[model samples]
Every structure is written in C-alpha cells, then in structure tokens.
Target chain A: MTASPTPTDAPPLPWTCPFCALLCDGVALARGETLELRGSDCPKARQALAQQPADTAAATPTIDGRAASLDEALDAAARLLAGATLPLFAGLATDVAGIRSLYALASARDAILDHLLGDAIMASVRPLQDRGVYYTTLAEVRTRADLIVCFGTRPAERYPEFFRRIAPGEPRRREIVFVGTDTDPAAAGPDTELEAVPFAGDAFDTLALLNALAADRALAAPPPGPLAGLAARLQAARYAVIVWEPGASGAQGALVGEAINRLVGTLNARTRAASLALGGSQGGYTANQVVTWLSGLPLRTGLFRDGLRHDPWALATARVLAGRNADLLLWVSSFDPSATPPAADLPTIILGHAAMPPVAGAPQVFIPVATPGIGAAGHLFRLDGGVVVPLVQARDDGLPTVAAIAGAIAQRLAAPASGAGS
Target chain B: MSAPAAVFELRLRALPRFRVDLAGVTPLALGALGEAEAGRVAIRHGNEALALGELFEIRRRPANAPALHFEGDLSRFDRLAWEMEDGEIRVDGPVGHYAAARLRGGLVAVAGDAGGFAACEMAGGELAVAGSVGDFAAAALPGSMDGMRGGTLVVRGDAGARFADRMRRGTAFVFGNAGDFFASRLVAGTIALGGRCGAHPGWAMRRGTLVFAGETPAVPATFVETGHDLRVIWTLLARDLARAGGPFTALPDRRVRRFAGDIAVDGKGEWLLPE
Candidate 1:
C-alpha cells in the first residue's frame, strides 16, 4: 500500500475517526508541511493524527524479537496455528472487514473467537437475551426522542461527540434528564431543559423503585423528593428515551441497564418510551454482531464439533487462557497503537497497528496492519446497531490491511498438511 | 401437477444465532411465489443481508397449502412465526427468543423448549410449547404497553423469571415451576401456575387473576391478604385450566384463599392460593 499524496496547497479533507464506536466522520485533516487535524478534535482523534511518521517507521514483521520477512512471519504463525489443538483468536479491535476475515480464519481452525470487550458486550447482551430491552438507534435519539434520561455514567467522558450528535435541531427543544450521577449543567442548549434525579443506594434498587413508580405502584416509603416527581414527568412526556453505558457502570453496571429496561417497558405501557446504550468503544458492538451472525451466539463461544456453543463464563478468553485450554493465541488490534498482546505463557501471533510499540518480550510473529479510516477504507457498525458508516482512507502507512493478513493466514491454514511438513 | 396438502418445509442446515425475523413470511403470503422467489426472501445474519434459501432449505411439498413445518434443533432460531396473521407453523424442535412474538392469528406449536420473550406482545394466537420456556413468556416486549393482548400460551415444562409480565389480555397456563416476579405489574389477564413459584408473585399488579394451585412464594409488602371467597370466578377459571390439562386439572374442587393488593397500585389484582 502507498501513502496518499499530501498536496502542499490543498484544503483540509473530511475524515472519519475510527478509534471509537461513535465513528465521528466530520474530522478535518490537512496534510500540510505539518499534519493538522481540525473539526471534532477529540483528544483521541487528535492524538491519533498528530503522531510523526518517523516514529511509526519502525513497523516490521518479527519472529521472537528478531526482525523477519513477511513470508517468514506468516509461515511461523501458520506453523504455530496448524500444530495447536485449540487456538484462541481474540483481541478483535478492528473494522467489519477485518473481523469478517478473522471469523473465516477462526472457523477453518475451529478456534474460539472473542473480542477485547467480550465482558462488556455480555453485560448488555445477557440482559437483552434473558429480559428483552427496547432500544433506539442514534439517529432515532437525535430526531425523534424528546425526553433523554441519562442513567449512571456521563456520555462526554467516553464519547465527546455524543451530546453534539444527539442535540436537537431548529424549532425543537429536548429535555436532558440525568439519573444516578451528577453531570455538567452546561452540556445542553440554553433552551433545552435539564433535570437531575440523583438517588442513594445501588443502581438496581433505584431502578426497581423507578420501575414500580412507572407501574403506578405505591412505594411503602416514598423515595427522595426529586425521584417522586420522575414518575409524573415520564408519564407526561410525548416521547422519552433512557440512556446508559454498560462499560462505565462499575463491575455489574449492566444490571443497571437491565433494571432501566424493565422501567422502560413499564413506562411504554401508557406512553412512547425507549432505551439507548451509549458506550461501545473499540469496535465492541461490531465484533459482537459479527460473532453472533456467524456463530449463532455472542462472544465467549467455542466452535465445537456439534456447533458454536456460547458460554460467556466458560469460554471467556481470560478464563480459557488461565485454564490452559488454548494452545495458541492470535491477537488482532488494528486501531490502537498501544494495544499489545497480553502476557500469556503460550505461542502468540499479533496483527497490530503500524504504530504499535514493541513489547519487551515479543511474540512468535508480529504483522503490522493498516488502521481503518487512516490507511484503509472499510465499514464500521455504530453503537446503536442501526447504521454502518464508511471508514474512508486518508493516508496509507504502507502497512498490510488486517483483512489481507488474516486472509493470508486462513489460506495457509486451509492447505494440506504436506505444506506444513516442510 | 399439484397433489395433496401443501406443506412448506424449512430444515435448518446451520445454526444461525442472529434473530431471523419471520414476521411477514407466512405460508399464505409465500404460497404464490415459486421456489426461486421464495429463496430470495430477506433475512439478517448478524450484520450481513442474506437470502433465506442461503440459510434454510425451502421447498413446497404435495399441494399448495398454508401450513409451514420446520425440522432440526432450532434452539438458535429467533422470532419464528412472529406477527403471523393467519396460518400454521410447527417446529419439530426447540426455538430461540421472541418465538411467536406479536402473533395475531395462527397456530404455532414447538415440540421442544423455547428461549425468552416467547409469545411476547402477541395480539391473538395459540402458542404451545411441549417442553420448557425461558423468561417473559406471554409478556410485553420492552417499551410496549400491553403484552399478549389476546392469545393462549401453554407451556408444559418449567418457566424462568418474570413470566407474563404486563400481560393485558390473554390466557397463560404454565404447568411447571415459575421463577421470580411472576405476573408482575400485570394490567389484566389470567395466569395459572400449576407448580411452585419464586418471590414477588403479583408484584404491583392492578387487575388480574393469578391462580397458584401449588406452593406460593412470599407476596410483597404492598400486597395485603383480602381473604375474599372467589368461588364463582375460581370455578369457571379452574374448569378452563383443567381443560388445558396439568396439576390444575383438579383446580375446580380445591379450596382457595385470596389476597388482593399491589395496594400500591389499584389493589384489584387477585392471587388465589389453594388451601
């Protein structure tokens, strides 16, 4: 791959930042004498684009800490995978194309595929599976929802563009209601009304009371004053949507989401209401969707002989590694440069971003891959599971795409044992 | 030449985890189309748009009839017979989430167990599961006001948590043990649990009849024992439950004690405990 030419006199180009699930596509990139990034200059996007090319020039395939040719690295990785009884293809932080190729490789090897955010995905998915949730897409939240009730975590810390994207347009005003946590009062428009329903006790108990309130049940001891009015406010709304993030809600924060979902269910009985989950950073939702479609199960599943068996607890990547159930590990992180292979006592192969720093003790093989929306163009699913935005190529760092690397590995795995005999 | 009964058979060749929304693809709707067109029916596999023929084998057998049959263990298949207006769909094996969801008019029978949210948000239909069922059966979908506005859901085996939640109008009879929060926040309906139940049965229910023929769990503080004699409704409901068959077969003759409260709410919901 060749880097796109940076004209000395051209205007800034609109680029989509692929670092987060928000897929904020309005970034302006100007490749002048010094690379300049403007627009939603989020800390993550700015940091990603401000790196000097010289620092990333050290990207090269390696075998056991020693520099090696691409063929030599692929050969070594294939040898390790072909010899292993059970392999784990994990640390999937890439675009749709990258994950699709990884799924193919995992299927050929009958390996267990898991994402970096497997636990977080399960936190939300478990509730949706056991107890259904009514969710809306980001677009729906932007245009239709009138009452936005944010539960627990603040959206700005993780997704800086969250408030900007969901801000209502002209002639309309939205009400921003925060529950569980205190937030900045100035995040919304001056015309927009903001309210906070702070409560004591855990998220589960608070939401349970809210559920009963929404159901019009009388509480033995009524909750705090602010909470007492929440039921009436929700009932009076024309269209209401509750928002929460499973990842930031503590260890069992997803339980809060489950409770909020039940409340939404109860509220919808009389009025129009829905729920929205905010955080899906690092391509977690995309990976979960891909895995579910191909395997008929979510993350933490094994490609057993019968079929893919989903056991979030048993098939967790960490647990599988700790139990020594997997003989080989294939870590793929194509977006974050600092995302290195986890310290495991097993043969490891890495398909990482070009700017990824070298670990003290390197893996058996390391192949630097192009970051989507930077060096390659691909599709990425948004957090709401409604939109699949395009990741346009801005500049190529002369690195192979994860799809090409994983595809090469899959082809080698499908070959006869004679190919491995040598 | 068109022969005997028309039976459309879809045998699962591979397990699909993503829910296949079988909402509009009924036998009557697809009977006019040829095998090729039927194969082109749209279904979602994860993020990809796939053809129904790519996943299931679609074939019309004997004659052109409005009856569909499925074979294989479809425990991963979701939303089967969803919102079907009029037809017959039979699953020879287990099914996944939202099986027969929003069903209007149909006869859907699963020979094996079913996943959560089965018969959810249904308007009218008859859904029978020969084996067990997961949570929220005959319950409203998330953010929907009414659950199973009109239908009949009969689960032969055990049911998990939050069964019949917010059911507005329907008749649900579970023959086995039910998990926590049974008939919780019920607006109006008839629920008969022939086996033991977990905690918080009839939590905050407004108006509904929950008949517990077996051991009943603890009622919430919001609920107060009314000790009312409901022999008239009990006799009629018991006979209907007996017709469904189960431990409730002898429901008519048993003496009952009543408690009405979710006083928290309308306090009109009735919980009949067999004495």
Candidate 2:
C-alpha cells in the first residue's frame, strides 16, 4: 500500500489526543477529506488532529534511499537487524501495543531499548529511585489538598487545564503558592489565596533549606527570608501538596527532588502532605510505567538473557551511537507530526510519523507509520501513572500502526529465512 | 570443576547520563558464557543501548577469583557496582553517585574519592573508599525509610554533608572529617569517625552508635550526658573498627566517653567521644 486509502463510511468516533501524556479522550473528531476536532480547545490536540499523512511519494517505505514495497522494506529491515551484533532500539514514542511489540522484537534480537524522552523522564525517575516519591493523582489534589505549592514550574503552560480541572469546584478554595518566579493569578479559584515566593537560585539549596526550616531544624541560613512563612502555611493546612517539574528545576534537579522528598517526610511527621511532579509529557509516563511493570525496570533497559538491567544513563541510544556502541539503530515515533527520527551516523531504521520530513543525504530506511489515536485504536497511560485511557479508531488513515509494522517485522524475524512470508 | 575468574573491566570513554547497571554482568556470570556471548552483554549509557564490547575493550583472562575492574576516572559514572550480588569491583579512580547502592553482596573498592550516596541502602556488601566521599554515604536512598540496613562502608578520607543520614543497620568508618548533620536521623547503625565533624551530630537519631576518635563535636541539647559504662559494647565495636585498619588501628586502645540522646525524636542514639 503506497498511500492511505480514504474511508468514507466509518462513523465519527470520540478521539483521544496522543500529543501529550494527559490522554484527553473527550475530543470529538469529524473525519473526511480533511479532519476537524472539537470539544477540546487544546492547541496540541488541534494540531494533532490536523496532521495529514504525506502523499504517496512520502508514504512509501524507502530502502537504500529508494522507494520499495512494504514486503521488500520489511525484509531489508529484518536483514539489517539480523546481521547486527548489537542493535539499539530508541525513540519508543508509540502506543502501548506498539511498544509491547517492539519490546518483543528487541528481546528476540537482544537489542538495547530506550525512549526519546528517556533522559528527561529519568530526571523524575532518578529522584524516585534515589529517595522515594510521594505522589497524589490529579483527582486527589482537587478534593483533598487545601494547599498547593508549585515549585520551579507553571503547570498551566504544560498541563493547560491543570488549574481549571484540578481545583475548579473545591468546597474551601485551595491556597495556591508558587515557589518559583512564575505565577498565574487567574488560575486561582474564587476565594482561593494565591502567593508567589520568588526563588531563582539553585533549587537544591532552596529546597534543602525549606525542608530544614519547615522541620523546625536550626539552620544558620534558611530559605531566603520570604520563605520562612512557607513553613507556617504548610503546618496550618489540613492537606498540602508540593508540585515540581524535574525538567525545569535547574542543576541539581535530583537533589531538588530529594529536598522535596525530605520536606514531605518532615511535613508528614505532623500533618498530611504529598508531592506532585508535573512533566510526564509525550507518552513518557506510559512507556515508563509499562516498562517498569514488564521488566521490573524503567526505560533505558537492556534485555539480558538472565534478566533486565536498567541504567538510565549508560544504555542511551544517543550515547550508544556517539560512543560507537550499537551497530544498528531502530527509531520509532508514531505519535505527533513533529516527532521525527534523530539523525545519527549509524545504520538506522525509522518507523516514524507520516508527516515527518525526509532526511537529506542519509542512507537510512524510513517507513511512515499511522498515528495512534487518529488512525487506529490504542491504549495509553496518563501522567498520573495509574490511569490507562483508550483511543477509539476515529478514521481509516489506511496507514499501518506501529504495532502492526513491528508485529510484522517480528513475525518475519521468526519465520524461516526462505519462507514465502518474506 | 571450578569456573575460571574472568576479569570484566570497564574503561571510561565519556560520561553518559543513563548509568550502566552491571547487576547481572558479574565475572562469575560472564566467565561461564562463550567469548562472543559474553561480549554481546547488553548495557545502557544514558538513553543509548550498547554491547559490553562496544564501550570497553574486553580482555578476558583465566584466574582463580571473580572480579570486575574499572580503570580511568569514573566520577561521572553513577551506580558503578549497582545492586551487585557476587564478585569484586575495583575502581582505580573517583567514582560517581550511588556506587554499590542497594548492593546485596560483594566487595566494591574505590581507590579514589566517591560521589554522594555511596553504599546507600546496601543490604549486604563491603564498600571501601580509599578517599573522601560526598553526602549520605552509608545512608538510605531518598524516599527509602531506612538507609544502609546492612553492609560495611569504610571511607579512608573525610565525608561530606549528612554522613550516614537515616542509617538503619550497618557499620560506617570515616577516617577524616565529616560535614554537618553527621549521623542525622540515624535509625540504627554504627558509625566510627576518626576526624572532626560539623554541627548537629545525631540531630534526630532514633537509635545508633556514633564513635568520634577526632575533635569533640557539640552534642545536641536533646541528649543527656550519662557517666555509664558501655565497656562491653565499646570494646567489641572498637575491635571491629581496629580490624578495619587506618586510624581505626588504634581505636581499640582509646578510652571512650559516651553520651546518649537525640531525645528530639526517640532519644536512643549514642555518641562515643574518645577521652
């Protein structure tokens, strides 16, 4: 199939936006010659719905820089992987099924596995590993937390509807405090008090001092003079929540997380408190949760014969290429249009978004894959790491999903070398 | 028939974010595999996947002992001997964070300084650092309720901030100075420091032993000085400390003045001062 054949008869289905980790499933989509999205005003969702597969020229898989049939392309990709002594499977940005199939293939080939946001995701994960994390779902924050503190991040920028959806109609309005410089006064619900504690220095020191001061520990220098009141507010609140984004926290981010963990621990000594770490965008949480459940390790894991070995730093696909470690690179990005395969000087195969532009002067294989929520039904985990949302098939984009393509490749790999399947 | 000792050496190339977890890649484990199969051992550096042979130049030789040798500066490498169960890991240079963290069993020796949280949360193992180490050495991992539950961490040089914070059960020996909040929130463990320590020793210690062989540290107000005889415990502990060598070689002969408190939390942890 060179191009996605348009389906004219399928009924309109409620769509799930895979552009972000929220997995907002309330979107209503109208499919036709052109797609239309409604019910959600998120710019990301609109952009995702507007993504159209490239023309026939771009949809066809290319091998050795030449357009080829799907069978020929799959065979070529399989052969490249079969010959590779060490293969790196990176950019795991597809749906749940896709990643599962990919993992099976990687296991069969004993390939190294990772995700595009593995580093960013690991920033949050490292803190979880080093010290433990105290987390509450968005729903709990809405109902329970009387105080909300955002540390070094503005949730509205990333989770656009965070403030509106979280504390919209609480009984006694939740008090909002921003530990960093940024603030959104309007996000504060009616009768809710909003305060900002400006801190633009190293987060490690700030958080550490805050924990000490809050715990009533005597320190020569405490979190700047302004934050002294923070401890009092925390003690007064029935339920307090501290929110932070590991990606935005400056150097010593993990230490900042440690400090937050300590702060929560100290608060729990007397009253109720928890932490809310915000950045789990781009299916990062889904991938991490899935991998953690399956292999008892998160992303950046190497499938060993004995067991899975997780190393957030060492098993990176980028590092593998730069260090000349892996002989083959398999990149998968089947979500957003802008999710393109990273350019690397290695034998590479890309199962990428249809809207991805062709790379210049690279002898890499490119196979355009279908968008999960838009073109096919799929499952994804939300940022909370607990909720799993379903994507209803809204339209027949005629393109193959990453799961299908990966499944095909895995089947081909398992088949006899001279089988008619190839 | 005994399996030959296979030396699995990892030489530093450049620092990567995702640490390499050599949990299952032990000398004993790899020694049984074929040369090619051993070379194909999977490892991750940052978000990249790599084979054992790709990052390090492998030279497997026959020996009687199983050990993993790390050459060159590994200050940026985290989790050097992560969760290691069996074998010996020898580092020639400074190691990074979480070295031998959650280690169940084995001997991890670093010839140079180690980064933060070295030997943290280790259940069973012997981690010896020839040089100073950063904060939280022999302490619990962040979020973990208990720090080093079991194992022995010997730091030849000074320790940084919050040394042995939240330790539950273990023996930590520091030959040099220690930073502030040394032995803070000690749940249960034995820490022997041969040098001066910063403020707030045993801040909220629930139960543990802090042996100071160097300058006298300020005792927290929560602790009450008691002229009691802990001769049996001290003598036995001093003997163990003496066996560790370095400044501890003379620890058994020194007279100890004991003060118990950390009454702020549970008031059970003790501080032993060399008289």
Candidate 3:
C-alpha cells in the first residue's frame, strides 16, 4: 500500500531484511499486474525467485499468494483461525515487529504457538533455566570467554560466520573445543581442539563423563578418557564454557530436567558456562526468541492446554505420531513446504512462507512474503544469542513484509474479540 | 518474637548436583524459590547469578514442613537432592536424570515425571514422582554393585526400561503400569507393581521380591507365584499411596495377592498384587 516505485524507468533499490536466520539481504520486487519478486546478486535468492510459479495457480500458491487485497487475505486467514479450538499461530520470528501482532493473536485465541526448533531451543536453555544461572550475550563469547565448547554441533553448517563471530576480535588467540561428534581438527582454524567421543544414543553418556571427571576416575573408559584430570582442569579454569546442540539431550520433562540442570549448574558452580543455540531449525533463533517471549517458557510447551504444560515425549508432532501423545498436528515452519514434515501420518495444517511443495493431509497454506535480508529492510537477531543486525534494503515493491502480513492477520482476528485496541 | 534477621535469597538455576546457599537453610525459607528470568535463571542470595533468576522467587512463607518449591523446565537439572538431610522439595516440571541421586532424607515430590537414576544410591529419603522416570531409576550409579539402601521411592506413573536393576535395600513401588526389566538383582528390598510388570523381572535375584498386580507381558526366568494375602503391610502401603494421591487409595478394602519371587533364593521377598 505504500507508493508504487513511482513508475520509475530505472530499477529501484531492493529492501533487505535479516530477521530470519537466512540473512539473505538484497532483493528487488514489485507488483504491476501480478506480484513480482526479484533477488539481488544473491544466488540463493535469485534461484528461489526464479523457481516461483510464472503466474498464480488456482489451488496452490505462487510468488503472490497474498495477491488478493492484503486486507481480504488477512481477514480470511484471521476469521478461519479465530474459530478453531487447536489454532496454532506461529513462525513469527521473520519480522520482529510482527512478533507483537503474533502475541496479540495467540493471546486472543489461547492457541499453541510454536516454531521449528521447539525442543532444541528449550533444551539448550534448560540447564540455566533450572539452576538459576546468568544470561550472557554473544558479545561475551567474542570478548570475555577464553575457551568455547561446542558439543555435538557444528556451527559452520549453518551460521557460516559463527567461528569468526565468537572467535573474532580481541586477543584472537581464544581456544575453541568441539566435543561429541567426530570432526577433522584441521578444518576449524588455528589451535581449536576437536575431541571426538563415540556418539551414544542418549545424553547419560555426558553424565558418565562428568561423574568420571568429578570423581577423578580413569580406568580406560571410552567416553570419559581422562575423567579425573578433566575434572581438575574444569575446576581450575578461569572461565570455561560448555555448549551442546539442542538434540544432544533428549526431550525435557519435570524430574530429568531438574537433574540435568543440576548437573550443569554443578559443573558451572566452579566456573562460567553458557550455551550457543545453533538455530531454531537448521540454525534460526526466531523460534527461540518467540517462544521465550510468549509462554514465559521455551518452545514445545503444551500451551494448547489451559496452562503451559510440558510433555516433550508427547506434544511434539513426531512423538505424537509415534503414539506418545494427543493427535491432530498443527505444524508451523518458516521454510519451504515440500520440505519434510516431521510427522507425516498425522492430520496437519502447515503454515509457512516460501515457494515450496505441498505435503499430504497437512493442508499447506502458502504465505507469499518478503525474504528477511533479501527482500526487506529490518533488524535481524542472530543465533549467537542476541546479535541484532540491521538488514540492508534491496527490494522495490510487491514484496509484502512478513510483519505487515502478520499484523493484518492479527488485526482481523482481534476485530471479532477486543476490537480497536486489540 | 525477637526480630528475625532479614532473609537472604538465592535464585536456583536448573543444574544437576547444583549446590547453593540453602545448605543449612529451612524449607519454609527455601519454598520462596521460583522460575521467572530467561535463560535458565533463578533468584539466589541477592547476588545475581546465571541459569534462572534472583533468589526467593516465591513470595509466600509457610510454617512447619516447609518445602523448596521449583518452577521451570527442570529436565536438564539432575540429582534433585544429593544426601539431603531433611525438609522437602517440590518441582513444578519434569526433572532430569538421577533425580534425588543419593537422597539421604526428607520428602522430594515432583509434579511431573523424573529422569534416570531416580533416587540412585539413595541411602535414606522419600521421593514421590507423579509421572514416570527414565531407566536405572532407584538403581546404583553405573559400575556400582548396589542400588537403593535406606528410604522409600514411589512412582505414581509408568517407568522406562530397567525399573530397578541392582537393588540393595529399601522399597520402590509403582502405582500404574511398569516398564521392562522390572527388577534385576534383588539384594534385599521390595519392588511392588500396582499394574502390569515388564519382562525378565526378578532376574538373578539373591533376595527381595518383585510383585505384579495387573496384566503382565512375559513373567519369566526363575519366578513363581506364592499365595494371596491382605496383610497389615498392604493396608499400610495402600493407605500411604492413596493419601499421596493414588487412583485406588480410597478403596484399600480389597484383598492383595502376594507373589513370592526368586524361589531359588531365600524367597522372603514377596510381590503384592490386587486379588
């Protein structure tokens, strides 16, 4: 609804947004007759835009799913969701401003809001959440931390600049330790220690190592090579950091969680320990941010119930499909649709943005929206914890902002309930 | 009353074997803990720390039988109480593995399920779990020959595989259906199942009993039924479990079937089933 590119003859500057983990920052788009999407010099964005359907299809969505008057599409999306019992409005991290709108909608519906990495984010923060530890920003890692531990995760696979960010700046001689999975030590840059521990199916192995270390025992154990010595080193460290991937530990519950957090807290009792969540999905932090801000708990909370209940083995779509918890899946992801849905058998309603394919039973509602960095200008918080970066703009028009769409939907939804203020 | 010194607070983070300022503190004062801050934080002794938030999250104060109340996702925090002396702890969410690892005394009640090593190496204490626990619960630490010794461990819901491996002493019971590998080496203790029991239960038992009250999967490998009874112990256990919130606590009038286990051994251990 903003002024059209003024019918300029030359191409207009594209707006880039880094809200999503993608950080695809420059793109050119507009709506003359049909919605158009253009990517900057970014290869991935160009490929995605080119893959968009030449024109809008009858059933499936194209580059312009919300081509209809933004008001009309938002109204339909809102009215449809407002009446459902299991309404789940999620995947709002793409645009920070839109998060406010999402909060409004979720409150109004009393619905379950989730993201791709529900369990992972919660698990990453579980230890600190339970034992009452301090919260540190990524800036701490870049400066204060002398040693960094990445257990069962590789940041390069997603956040390409992870090493540069965490190991960048002052002293530059910081040491990095990667544990759990096997990795070629040479690949990680200078002086980084990569310890390979045979992958066990469960996290109790870590506990075993801790026990060996804390007890100063070493009888040629596999996972815990030199427990006693390790414990001593850990206890004597000035500021040691331990980090693990989300799935490194299984799901969370009441008791086991307390036990795990206690373990972490005990380890950190003598030193400083913090975690770096890779991302919500492949490495996105939006899901983590959204879930924390809303439920006062992490993702995978059974907010669908009156109070936010936590049943990891149950609530997850996969677990539910595994015949662990209730049915009727409501999946929300900010990625391509044709991509795999965690639980294939359960009936689902997949809400996402991207030129992706459709999954069976899970009715795919394609939401044509702007790419964080490539299509719009906005602030993008990275997964290093809190790395808020301003996205450079590149797109011209027709690219509806994710925040704008979320806002319209919230407005339409609140119309029936609280009216104006809502 | 003489003016009491101002209360000091400490926020508890979700970490196993987590030790804080409450070493000599009373439960009445401990119950003031909560989960509010972001990133696994808790309030503690005014001095700001990590994990959860500031100490004394709970605002209310209660007398006698004071309890330490925890509010947050405790799945990562293990060892609910390590050699606890006294008092009680109530967690709002599921706890991580080894909840109550080596619990010495007092009541540790969880609003949700627990993790592995539940009451592991427990010398003396009482733990009540509303949900199921992970493997090796109430069992000894890996490589340790003995399991629970002194204390009572009760699980209201089902348990994972290997319910109780190497039991030494004490009593461990489940109200609902039990998991696989019910009981391994019965050194000297009692494991009573109110519902179905898992396979290979009571294997290599020197003494002690593994009881099944409901439908079982494959009762096998050196275990035979003994006799039925409505003894005073059953009445006492039923009353206690019921009062602790059991589905059949109010109806303890029914007869309890007794199944003697590992006849190869002394066979003094007996499993109590609902007749």
For lDDT, the strongest prediction is: 1
Candidate 2 lDDT tens digits, B143-222: 57888889899999999887887889989999999997788778998998888998667766789999888788865444
The lowest-lDDT stretch of 10 consecutive residues in candidate 3 chain A is A56-65
Whichever of 2 and 3 has more lDDT, that candidate is: 2
Candidates 2 and 3: which is better by DockQ? Answer: 2
Query: Against the hidden reference, what TM-scores do the models get?
Result: 0.63, 0.68, 0.53
Could you say which candidate leads in TM-score?
2
lDDT of each: 0.77, 0.75, 0.52
Q: Which of candidates 2 and 3 reaches a greater TM-score? A: 2
Q: What's the residue-level lDDT of A141 in candidate 3? A: 66
Write the candidate numbers in order of decreasing DockQ.
Answer: 2, 1, 3
Q: What's the count of clashing pairs in each model shown?
A: 4, 28, 106
The C-alpha local distance difference test score for the whole of candidate 3 amounts to 0.52
Residue range A1-422, candidate 1, lDDT tens digits: 23556785677777777777888887777775555667865776777676535334578898887888888898888988777657788888888888889888787777788887777777777668656889998778778877888887677777777877787665577788888777655457746888778864556445666776788776566567777687678787888898888877664554567677877887788888898887556778888888888778777777743367676654678866765667788998887877777777888898987767776653468888888877788888888876888888776567788888988887787778525421
Ranking by lDDT: 1, 2, 3
